[model samples]
Target: MFPKTHLTIAAGATVLVAATVLMSPSSNVEAKRMSYALDLEQGSVSAPAKGPASADEQNSGEVKTDTASSSAPTSGEKGQTEATVAAAPSEPALDWQAFEIKSGDTLSSLFKAAGFNDGIMLSVIHGEGDADKLQRLYAGETIRFASDDQGKLAAVELQRNRLKSLKVSRTDDGFKGQILTREPEARPMFASGVIDDSLYASARAAGLNDKLTMELTDIFGWDVDFVYDVRKGDRFEVVYQDLYLDGKKLGTGKILSARFINRGDERLALLYTDDAGNSDYFTPDGKSMRKAILRTPIDARVSSPFNLQRRHPVLGVVRPHEGTDYAAAPGTPIKAAGSGRVISAGRKGGYGRAVVLQHGDGITTLYAHMSRIARGMKAGSRVKQGQTIGYVGSSGLATGPHLHYEYRVNGRPVNSRTVKLPDAKPVPSSEMAQFRKVADQRLAQFNVFEGREQQLAMAEEE
Candidate 1:
């Protein structure tokens, strides 16, 4: 009996040693079994297993993580999991479609092409806040839209340009729209060039766009005759605003100051705004750069001049030509020579379609032979100076397309080309101090740019 008991005891001790070895900390299976829960939900661990608190938990008063657990995430794995959750988008993904606006494309047609009906489009068009701007859609713009799973229009965006857009979204009440605009960073820019062939050619060589070139001419048009006075040595210096978006040039802004040298005579114009928000170009001594009326309303050469004893081109008789005739292409815009009220707008005997404006100081101007009158130009309607009243056309008894312009003072016909134009009002006495401040600043900027350009030219010459 004693021998049998000894053998049984020895076998039990061996089995106990095998169990301890399987459960040891060094064993891979044991380490996995003792792992902590890596996933946490709602800022807490659910159904946590009771264990001794780690040093971290003891100091921070937080739940302890089972470091011995094989399922516990490593530092890298923990970071990755947290990042993924953070990176998850809050809104659902959408499939957007883009459509480019072409010529003659209407909103209805674009909506139909995008698999939508006119009803949806009308709703978007009738949306709030600048939604009416969509009615005047321009070519080369883009439109993007998205729909829900139910095929209902969810959102629409009109990309007018790179920096301007309009976005409309679906709401319970109705579609709401908001104009989105990105302000471009404005940087001062300068350009200078001497005229050899023409103002446009020299301006283009100096990196000035057609718009800026025209503006430069208009700034000095009151004092200089660009059509006849510009010489080969005439030069121009412009300090303007260059707009940029994301380090790329978007376009140009206003001309801050400009200097034009015409026929060896230099004229400078500085832009200024008064306390009442009236903005105009002015000379250094506070003289208005604008004249009461334009010397020549249109930018065309004089085909016929005002004369008292001249032979008529069509009638073949010696008659008094009271007005000057400008030769231009058909459909060229004719401008209002000065701010005035239209005394007459319609056919008048020898004059085809004519518009006569009655101005202050008993001055009257007439533009005859127009293809069509601009909208809002009618008898008793007021017009601003430089506003387009009609397009060039041979409406009256004429040989070809031309504008017969007449300017009169006190009911007496005068030579529109040779008559001295009256000057506009100068800077108000109350605003002279403010005007001087702005003038000085603009002049300083202009001078600095001019100096820089001269240095550059000298360096190139060397």
Candidate 2:
């Protein structure tokens, strides 16, 4: 209803106002630009977005401080060279998480301390999954506690057995745990030592312990009695396998080579296992170290017997004793002189805590003054040849701590000090040929295991 002149003039006024506003720079207007920089890949540090933020007002509050980033150019500055930012490298998840178990720490309490919720720890510890492992929640053992970004615990690993690491990523029904298995690893190593003193002492000086010592003894046990067989200046060299997992050593896997020299007699053995899983030690000449029986039957520490006619500490008697006695430190182990049965294990006059073993062919051996008898050691219990019967002590008419040991032939005491025991049982006349062949094969393996110098010197010593 308005005149044409009024409508036309109103439109012209709106257009002119829009033009002015577009030309003006408003204070609220923002132009955003992105920035980036190079940085070394040190894991454990979180990285932020590298792209530019949009100039939109809605997204302004979403930005965090970008670490490892360079600042952008300022306004009104001429463009300079822009260094292309390297892409941030990726990092794998952590292997273990450290956790300490305080007193009264049950599985439930530990799960809470490790930032876990209800039911997860109990399920895993109690084997709700297919792990089929025994549950362990000891107070001192550490465990590794791990979780995913969503905060679910995946697996649990004992951290040095004091702390637990739980990985909640792979559990059944969505609970995860540590990787369960690994491939087997085998490695070879060599050790050599000269016996300046005792074989065990020298081996220990060369960094061997109970486990390794047992390994060494087992390698040569078939050939050497170890107790009464080693001579001074005896040298031993062995090459064995070291078993490992994740680069950590577990134990000695096997003994490949071993050499022993007793009284200037040379004996070298190698370990050999046939296709049928039969293994033994044998000399290079194809002789089995395993005779029908071991030559020396005692496990005594000393080679010489006690001299009773000298100074007497308690009895004060200058009587020349008829028997040789062994002095073991109060409770040292005492073994049988041979495969025998208990003739008597009870007290006999001054032979306090004594045990008498009777072997076949009218031979009897006696041990006296024991600290205590091995449990269940009675007259009827069958004992193996080298099994411990009692500890050593001063019992009968003795001066100090020692075992009064006597050897008897046909019920009469004899000088065990001078008696030469019988030789090894010859291999069954029928099994002799096969035994020699088996022995030779083992000896060949031993040579391959020990290097050249060891073989030569061992040969000379033998």
Candidate 3:
């Protein structure tokens, strides 16, 4: 009986131990799991297991806790969680294709090469006003295309130049075009040169381009004859505008002011525009730089001077030479001395091909010995100053290719070299003050540039 009781007690104790192990807090194994919900719009992460209190619940001054449970969430909770996830918006991806225009390449061909059809090209071009720019494409330009994920063109951009572009973008209604322009920064620059052999050579040595050099000559051509008056030591100084884009020099703009020293004579010119929007070069004292007629009709050396009694080279007899002869290469262009009406344009007895111009104030000019007259130059046709009238040739009574130019006043021949040219109208008294103000500023700049050049020369010599 004692053995039976001990056995029973041991069994009872073992059962109690097994019950304690299953019911104790430490013995209860809780599996720790986490769930994440991404808020894509806000770019944040939310924990579903221990989410913050709801806004409505908090406003009522009550807190709702998510009680721990081993089962799945309720149907209402599941629906709310799914609604939060579906609120994010999706954006489509864009693909870009770029093409460089080549010689003989058309918009149609470029579009086809990029895997686009003619219909797409036509729709984009015919939709709006900007489509016209696509038709004016030139070689060496670039066009970029942007398309959505569905392969529909979203935008097109044409880079016209460094400072201009044309853009076309698709809208709900259609495509719209816009022209974009960027302003270039202007910087003041100075250039000075001393003539050693020729004006062009000296200008090039002074870092002047052909365009700027020509402008310089034109500005001072009224006061000095470039062919006859330019001496070996003549000097020039100029202040001009240098255009730049993105810190790189593109080209030159305009000559603000300049000075020319020829044969010990100094001449200054300033550019000014009046309230009437007329721009012209003027002297420091407000006098106009342009005259009624240019000094020479053609850029040629004088081969024969005006002589009363000279032995004619062609006829070999003493004859009165009434006009100055300009020696030039055959086919060289001859320009009209001033604006006038063509009185005659045809072949004469001794002057092979001749053109006569009748100007204002009873002044007339004639050009003879030409290879051919300029087309459209006929009797009664109006001609502007500096217009080409004919070409140089050894026609009629001539020894070589030359232009026999004669300037007459009231039917009497006059020496073109020594004749007093009529000056253009000066600045009116009402605008003199304004003109002087602008002129003073430009002249100051010109002086500054000249002084700097002088200092540089002195430094170089030292």
Write the residue-wise lDDT of candidate 2 on 1-462 in tens digits. 999999999998888778645644443332233343323222344445644445653455333335532233344331332322233334324444666666777666666778776677666755544332424555666766666556666567654331223333454575434534444477866666777778889888866666767877765665565766677788777666787776787766666666666666666666655445667655554455553322333445442354546444456667555466665578888777677678889777877888888777687888887877777577866776678888877766556677777877788776765555543343454655766676565455555655565687799999
- Each model's lDDT comes to 0.87, 0.62, 0.85
Ranking by TM-score: 1, 3, 2
Question: lDDT, candidate 3, residue 5?
Answer: 87
The TM-score obtained by model 2 is 0.55
- What residue runs in model 3 are displaced by over 4 Å at the alpha carbon? 1-96, 118-133, 146-149, 154-160, 163-181, 327-331, 393-401, 453-462
Against the hidden reference, what TM-scores do the models get? 0.73, 0.55, 0.70
Candidate 1 lDDT, 3-93, residue by residue in tens:
9989999999888778645544542333244333333212333445555556764566543236553244568987998899776643445
lDDT of 2 at 8: 100
Model 3: residue 60 alpha-carbon error in angstroms: 28
Shift in Å, residue 334, candidate 2: 3.2
Superposition TM-score, candidate 3 onto the true structure: 0.70
Worst 10 residues of 2 by lDDT: 76-85
